[model samples]
Target chain A: MKAFISKNKWTLLLLIAATALMLVLAQKTYYALIIALFGIYAIVATSLDVLFGYTGQISLGHAGLFAIGAYSSALLTIKFGVPSLLSLVLGSAITALIGALIAIPASKLVKHFLSLLMIAFGQIIYLIINSWTEVTGGSLGIMNIPYLNVFGFEVNSNLKGAIVIWVILAIVLLVKHRIIRSRVGNAFIAIRENTVAARGLGIDVQKYKVLAFAVSAAMTGLAGGLYAFLRGFISPETFNGTQSVLFMTMLLFGGITTLAGPVIGAIVLLLFKEVFQTFSTYQGLIYALFMLLVLFFFPNGIIGLYKSGKTAVMKLLSKRAEATRNGGAENAEN
Target chain B: MLKIDHVSMVFGGLTANNDVCAEVHKGEIFGLIGPNGAGKTTLFNVISGFYKPTAGKVIFNGEEIQGKLSNQIAQKGIARTYQNINLFKKMTVLENVLVGCHTQTRANIFDAIFNTKRSRAEHEEAIRRCREVLEFMGIGHLEDSLAGSLPYGDQRRLEIARALVSNPKLLLLDEPAAGMNLTEKDILTDTILKIRDLGYTVLIVEHNMKLVMKVCDRICVLNHGNKLAEGTPEEIQNNPDVIKAYLGGAK
Candidate 1:
């Protein structure tokens, strides 16, 4: 129990802080909804990190998977009268299956070809979502999606919705933490670092690659399901190829492999999106320039900058301590 | 035991290995030595399941494993190291070796996510074995360091440690002492001998004849994709064909 506490102290602290913030912002419905959206985006970005960051597989098709989750859940709740919670899980699972199917062929390709395949996948899904009038309601989209109901509690208010989403996000983060520290995560990193070496060590490179995709898709799908329930609507406009690119950008801007990087990236970028809402036309250009600046100055992302800054501070502190100690010794001798 | 039965690998018109046949006994340090382009590494690739030999069978423990995938071959108790160092550069030394334990561990994504009793046991067992192998390789102290950050010699040892943690019956080492100094080579020689003593049948492809001669129980000399000679170190030293093809007819 003590070991678990020590290992998960930071996670616990973060959860507490996020819950406190949510309670404080409970009266501000707009801000609460934005925080809920941040939670959703953070989940998607972290899932993308699992694929691109840990497994070294670039996927620009996550928005498609997200659409699948959102559409599946919305349809299940609206048409079939299924419970909201069950639909969310089933939707995520369905997306995971599709992700594994996509990975079967994608695993055979490398670099830009893989990226192209993922882009094509996202485009196809977007087109389907836009044109499938009977099911997806065409470009008009599906509306009046039910709010998430957890057993007896209805997450109708923005603050309650944010709390619930953040709770799910906490669970996702905890699960990700477990997997990353385990042998399965080790296999993913090995495959990323050196395929030949990983094979030599008896790791099934293709199997792990596909698994990464499936796991990533499952998490991203959950985020999509959450988004659908939170906003009570589903649309093709939100799950376009550009959104996929945005997910990747968030992963890169925060840091790829680290757990906290994606969350940080999602929150910061979402804040930027809100700040630049007035200049919507220039948002793309500004994001592109920001990404360029980040790539140049902090290639490893914001986490990398923080780490380096920490080390610099430590170095200066040690140097000052050493100089003072030497002066004290000289004075005593004199 | 491993038996390479008439194995041949041809890349288009280039015949890398032409009907090469050899037998490696249990718990013996077998050596394959040849000058440049002798198909020694090619033969290693064939046995390790990186390539489907054009013809012939690679039988490990009496099962034909030539056409199987590399990971499948590894599952059948065959583990190999590359000619170039292939340690996961960004991963810590412990993590690199832990990856070797993948074939032995049975924890899946569900197991890992839930931290089930089975997963916890497997993880602890893997770490225990990894630490043992790192200690055996004299790299226990450097387990937390990045594999890429290690010095060249230590990286080589870490690769061996990674291979060793798999607990394979047959260990295939391709040029283990490729870029080592004399002292490092001497240490490697001792490590190889220690590995052999640990009851693993080691098939090593090496250019360092001194290290090979000192540690190999039996050495096979290849020249231009053909077996030139096969014998103990003294017998290989005196064979006229081996002397002419490999030793340059000098000593």
Candidate 2:
């Protein structure tokens, strides 16, 4: 089990197989549907990790990008009669542009203050979706948007939806992984560590910060577009400021610096929420309790816990090996 | 070669550098000694393009570098080490040196995306350069060590190696012997001479009277941000103003 887990590529393949098997064995369509939602949220969460975890920028306005994508795709498909697929791509691009625009001012602000501003920006986006009755259907939301299809096969079922969402999430994760290992990634780390030092090394500090924000926004927007089509409808409440907080919390509760942390975080948090649904009315209080526990004990999240455990286990094993070696040497000498 | 002409920097009511003029020829070890708060560091900062002078210009190898950024100056054949040893603590010794080679790398986003041959070549070249610098500094065995874990003397030598990896024509060292013992200072002096032998000019700001006298081709003395005396070491040592400004117990 340890060897299988240590090989990342193998682990990923195993996970994909497990997910497929789980979907096949799932008795209810609703369970598959929840997994599909998890996949979409995981995509956005992982993209958020690219900017926040790797590059060290705190953005609480990602849900705004998500809403931008959802609304654009929805409005294009419903009001303008555009095809769902093209509308989805267009929504992502437009969302990216808006993200770039927002980053222009947002990148100048410091971290904690920037997160506050982002929260305010997220509120404004929600208010626009709520008040713009003529365009956004006035909080009622546009409905009956056509489902996505690739190569003439309509992906309407929950299993197909899960596959589609996972494919996109894989692409996003791949791009993020490549970027993290590149010189651009080095520049991002440099900026994260010491902006003054980065500038002193001739790196364009503002440009990289803005680029990080825009790239993260684009990926989040793409996830949003997919999410809207998957759900077939989107309401203003779906992307409230609270959703932004949840996204940030998910990223943090995972190891903020690891690639796999955000996905793990999203899955764990969503599972908690799903389990809380059994309690029906006290779900919010349960989530708050979980958050407090995470804050108190596992401040670095599950990944950090796993790392410390692995280290302790390795040390114990090495100590035993060293004792055996010493005993063998003594016996040989005797 | 480095040339500073009529460079004057005033900080509000107090002048940090007042019409300071000097030249550092190629392959020469130039010395700058000044009393405390006499703007020796301020002048070095100006030359390295950290503080823009209120007036005058700094030209290096026929290019005006006065108002340029510090990193740009570093890229344009100038490298400097700080008085407090500014190193990337989290990075390994080799990684810290490789970062100095950032300007020499030619791989862009496309190369990085595809992991192309060009990017691999650049990476290999950068590592080779880092190794060469570490070897030259006699800390090649410490390449895998974290920069923060290195001993004090090794840290100073590593700084020199980092600056040298950029292949600068001019190098500025600020107080390279501040905390060193006599043995370390001797090794540092030998290293300074070896660096000068490598065809690069060195401008050093130091308070170590013995090292400066032994290694410098010429010395410039400053007091109250003004040039007080300039000559060979022996001449400056006996000058009256130099005596009053430094080598005397005023504090």
Candidate 3:
């Protein structure tokens, strides 16, 4: 048992078992849909962490990337008669280019200035969707988008779609995880700590900052593409500044610096979205209140609490064991 | 070798460095001593490419490096430590040293993204180098400790270790012994000489007269950004201008 834990063999086994369980559930039941949603949101949040948490740069324009991917894929496939897979690929690629272009100038701005610029960028995306009636169908939105079919397998059911999303999310998460734990990740942390010190250490801080922005943008764009096809429709209202704020809230609530924080955050938040569905109008305010509570108490977010709790539990258990042994010794001596 | 030739820097009306010229030979423990605001630090900054001279040039190993960025200069084999230790406070000591070794590592984005065998090798190599550098500075035991939480003396030593990880040919140390007590300063003086013995040239800016006189092969005295004297320590200590600079006015 010690060897298994020490060598990470047990952890690997647990992960494989969990994945197999998820796959079986995905094939048999609707539970995988929830996991799929969690997986997609996690991928987006992790990508955001690379920008805000690691690089120490914040963005309020992520929903723009998401909306762009959705709109591009939905519009290209439905209206232009492009294949679903081709549309997904082309939409994300185009979104990535657009993201890079926006990030270039966006990186030059700092703090509130950059945030204001991103908000404006997001608004522009919203306006484009609403105003361009010829292409996007304006505020009415487009629907009945075709399902993704690969080698005669149609992604028509929620379970199958969930599987597809989860697989792609897994690939993205792995790639992003490796990137963040790499030299570039170290450079990002350096930039976060002190840009001047980073510069002094012979790091090209600006280049890495821009690269981080681009990579994150690409990932968010990909998420957007997946979302569009999954929903088979997307609207201008879905890509607003309010949605971007929700994404930020998700990142913050999950734990900004943690890899799995986003998953926890997104799942909880989305579940709340469902739980509060009856009082739909009050959901936003409730969410804001919940976030404030998290911020006030768990300022480091969910992961922080988890870590501190784990330490506290371990300390308590050790103390209890020590007290028991000492008590036993005292009794014996008596 | 570093040569600062007739470098003059004027900030608006005040000339910070007025045609200051100096030569730091390879592998010499050179010292720059001056009273407060004497521009000794400014000189060190200029040589390390943190500041651009208004006129003249700094030639490092026969390459003109005046007006380049500090990071670029560091890449060109010059490393520095601040008088006020600029460590990454939140990072572990090992991570801080790895940050210093950043420029030397040649791992590309793809290598890092994929965690390739080469990248893993480089990562291990970087960790090994960081360990060696920390051990050399006698702070290897504090590798996992946060840099900000370390005691002041150890933090200073950590800064020096981090600077060494860059494999610099010339090291610019700004007041390494400034705030240490007599006993601590004695240990630091030994440390400075040990560093000099390791085939690296050290140019130090210090106000600790005892440390300056003890370790420096030659000393340059400055008063209000102007050179008062430049000679061996004994010559510097006895020069009328040096005496005037340190003790108000020489009789």
Docking class of 1: high
Best DockQ among the predictions, by candidate number: 1
Error of 2 at B159 (Å): 3.3
Task: State the TM-score of the second chain for every model.
Answer: 0.97, 0.95, 0.97
Q: What is residue B152's positional error in candidate 3, in angstroms? A: 1.3
- Cα lDDT for residue A68, candidate 1: 94
Candidate 2 structure quality by residue, lDDT tens digits, B1-251: 78889999999999998999988888899999998899999998898777899999998989899988876876787888878878777667887787677667766655765778878888888899889889988999999999889988898998888888878788888999988889999989988998988887899999999999988998889888898888899999889888877667545
Write model 1 residue lDDT over A182-285, tens digit each, in one string: 88898888888999888877788999999999999999999999999999988899999778878888888998888889999999888898987898777667
Model 2: native contacts recovered, as a fraction: 0.24
Number of the top-ranking candidate, with TM-score as the measure: 1
Worst 10 residues of 1 chain A by lDDT: A281-290
TM-score of 1: 0.97
C-alpha lDDT score of every prediction, in listed order: 0.91, 0.82, 0.84
User: How does model 1 fare in lDDT?
Assistant: 0.91
lDDT of 2 at A13: 89
Off by over 4 Å in 1: A1-19, B247-251
What is the per-residue lDDT of model 3 for residues A234-333, given as tens digits with 9 covering 90 to 100?
7787787767877777888888877668867887887777667798777568768867978899977888888899799999999999999999999999
Worst window of 10 by summed lDDT in candidate 3 chain A: A28-37
Model 3 lDDT, full chain set: 0.84
